[model samples]
Target chain A: MKKELEKRTVTGPDGQTFEVEPLIDYYCEAHPTVQPPAYSKIIENLFNWARSESIWILGFGTGCGAIEMRPLMTPRFDAYRYGIQWRPTPRQANLLIISGYLSVKTLKRVIRSYEQMQSPKYVIGLGSCTINGGMYWDSYNTIKRLDDYLPVDLYIVGCMPRPEALLEGFNTLKRMIRAGNAEGANTYAANFDWYKTNQKRVIHDWDMPDYNW
Target chain B: MQQFEWIQIPYSLLTLFIVLNFGLLLNALMAKIAARVGRRRGIPIYQNYIDLIKNYGLRTSITHGIMFYLGPVFRLAGGVGLLLFVPTLYGSEMFSNLSFAGDLILALYFVFFGALGMALGAGESGHPHAAIGVSRGLSQMTMAELPFALAVFSVALQYDTLTISEIVKAQQGSLFHWTLFTNPLAVAAAMLSFLGSMMRPPFDVVLAPQEIPIGPPTEYHSSYLALMQTNRMIFPIAKIVIIMNLFFGGATNWPIFFAKVFLIYLFAVFVGVVFPRFRVEQSIRWFLIWAVPLGVLAIVLV
Candidate 1:
């Protein structure tokens, strides 16, 4: 744990020490907490029940992040060493790895795929692309924050993160899974204005036509 | 008795040998070229033949249904039918038995069987990306058909025959006899149209890796994948051969025909390097507006 802490300690924009897990904890705390779904504990327990064994992955290689998935699967890093194997179709996969930004066109496809998967499935956002659109924040397409639309269990932060970083993220997700907190509930009831402003900036500007439909 | 006496046995066998050898030779040759461009040390000249023979021995799985199984068989048959009809050289009857009496339009539609098979197989895969790619491939083909039809129509009118062999026979003289000189704009339009038809660069959006890994080849594996790969290796050579027979006289020897086709192929690669792929809508619009008009003009002029 001390070694993990040392790796995460870094200077932030304000020149203050920022520890990664603490920052994540703070962010999670800042958001409003909603009650877990009906039979929530059962879902949570079931999520934990399947975590340790046979971690089947539906790794959607959408963008540059797809290249990162190669090392994880191949001999060098060998994610299968941890019992993680890539499933061809989403229906058989336990975890959905959204490897990068969700283009509007691709997003529809992703949603359909997500729906097709069996229940007790978890989503791991691969990089900054899934978290906040990463470097493509200014692009006309791409969803800004994955959390706005789909439930993301883990946000593996990287601007094209390294293989080691991916392993670290996987470890973190494993820890979370063990805690019987697998089902990620959307805590915030409504932040319509805040989300709308971000959506406007990312998808369309004020100059674009306001279809209003 | 007289008819039996008139029949030339060795001549028929010679034609069979020529065609069987031609198909084997060209498929072997293009596999090397594609491997080289893809930056691999490479397969042996007969590697495709070995692969094809090996495919028959593999354990097969047919989950997606009948369309998937039927796709490659149809494509192979169509390719063979095309090879028979398109005249490769003067005074040859290589594909004479299968080559129905048809024109350039008939020849164009002949190869579309392969594309249709690929599209149907892709749709049956149950992968959204493959389905999307098939739709895009179909649309791109529709766009390309216009200018290509027009360009070939001009050639047909110039020579007054739809038979490719007749066209080549008519162009037996010097460079000036080629239809390429007769209408440079039509040639340019046809070549642009060919990019989409061939699914080469600037029109390779249907198979973009970043968006969709390989388009139709996405779900294919093992023997199914091998069949599709063979179709790709043969399809380009067949198309290039048609171009040669139409414009340049089909060479009686290898070097001249290969040289002309290579130059056109290089021109295609150069064009790909210069332009970026247009979106599906953009491709459709450009083909309809620019290509169709040029085609219609060529047809009118012819």
Candidate 2:
């Protein structure tokens, strides 16, 4: 149990050395990994066909852009026509929409949520805030680019992208998913350390481990 | 009654295959119809097929010990076993499957197998949401089952035979002879309970995806979810079939069976699309207030 805590002493600019206590007091285990069994080509094709048709989004609603998302469910925009759905839990969601601006506080939760999701997940950096922080570019807490912290498969640009634009983006995502071209999850895992470093730079007093899975 | 034939295995399997596909189609169609109610283009009728495939194709999985893994097995077994035990067509030998295995009482008891398995599996998964869901589900189930139980008891008493085939034979003479006509009060109570059992709105707080993120299946993913999804499709059909057999007169052929089952399934769908969900206590109160009295009256009348 002693190995669980690693002590670090750091000196502030004033040159006073202080013990750095680990901020994380509680622990919940990281999800265990089981190698997904291999499927034959015929089965793979069937899966691809299915994955293309249905996209269950992790409805995190990180920012104001989430306003646009409501219309997708409403009668006017109706994203269900393309088989798009919103899932409350990350485990059931195959897509994550970083809707609009992400504050450092929310990003930490976003990272945790993303990690909890099963593999083959895709991230959509929605609206200009997720692209380059949009109107809040100069805000202290808002992130400039979502791609730096999360492996985003697509970007839907606009101050707040309209529901129609979001629908168009979804169709493109469907096309990409159908072609078996979305490999963002693999890319994220390969460069996980880099993503963590970037994330930790923005988010301090982090309680969670370096990676969720 | 003890004729154990290997041929029945394949026949039961064949019925399972058909019901799986039919259930998928029925759910997708309901989703489409619900969308139309709001004047929107809904998902395609075949979307459930895609969903089942996509779920099975997920590339990663996390197991929460042994019971979580066995949960879906018990669920599917419950659905298939219940179907196999019920005679599909009164006169057809090939489609009989294993109806000789049990009577109506056995079939009624068999309905709990899946729910018990799910509760155990969800409990072991260690998600508080799952536990909350199971509790709500079991509680709601207790209230829902009471009305159905009374109706079943009344029907059994009315027929004076516990065998399902015998009950169906009793209702065979004319459309007017069906329980919907013969025992209108019991059928009304049973259908209301059917809506509750279907997990439609006002009774769907157990899943409450918005509040609990799909409750019991919150921790489930990939092929584990796929197994549950397969059961989701089959279990409802199995439940509806029993209701149809006991109340609507067992179908004489495949087409009649499809029509009857779809109509019964649609009753839940129609209610789901328009109504908001009930809190657990609210649902319990609602069932006790409205359904329980009808069931009691039906029993008193019988």
Best by lDDT: 2
- What tens-digit string does per-residue lDDT give for candidate 1 at B1-302? 01222234544445445544554566555434553554443344554444443333222223366887777666765665565556555544432223333446778888688888888887877678888888888888887877887888877777778777677777777788777776665676677687776665678878875577567656664467556656665566667778877766666665675577666766666566567787788888988888888877777776
State TM-scores per candidate: 0.54, 0.92
Mark the 10 consecutive residues where model 2 chain B has the least summed lDDT: B94-103
10 residues in a row with least lDDT, candidate 1 chain B: B54-63
lDDT of 2 by residue, B95-163 (tens): 766886336877888788888888888898888999999999999998899899999988988888777
Worst 10 residues of 1 chain A by lDDT: A204-213
Candidate 1: misplaced stretches above 4 Å?
Answer: A1-213, B1-60, B93-100
Among all windows of ten consecutive residues in candidate 2 chain A, which has the lowest summed lDDT? A25-34
Among these predictions, the greatest TM-score belongs to 2
Q: What's the C-alpha lDDT at position B124 in model 1?
A: 77
Model 1, range A48-102, lDDT digits (tens) per residue?
5345334657757767777898877554676754646565655445577788777
- Residue-by-residue lDDT tens digits, candidate 2, A123-167: 999999887888999999999989999999999999878888999
Candidate 2 residue pairs that clash:
B202-B278
How high is each candidate's interface RMSD, in Å?
Answer: 15.2, 2.0
User: Model 2 segments beyond 4 Å from truth?
Assistant: A1-42
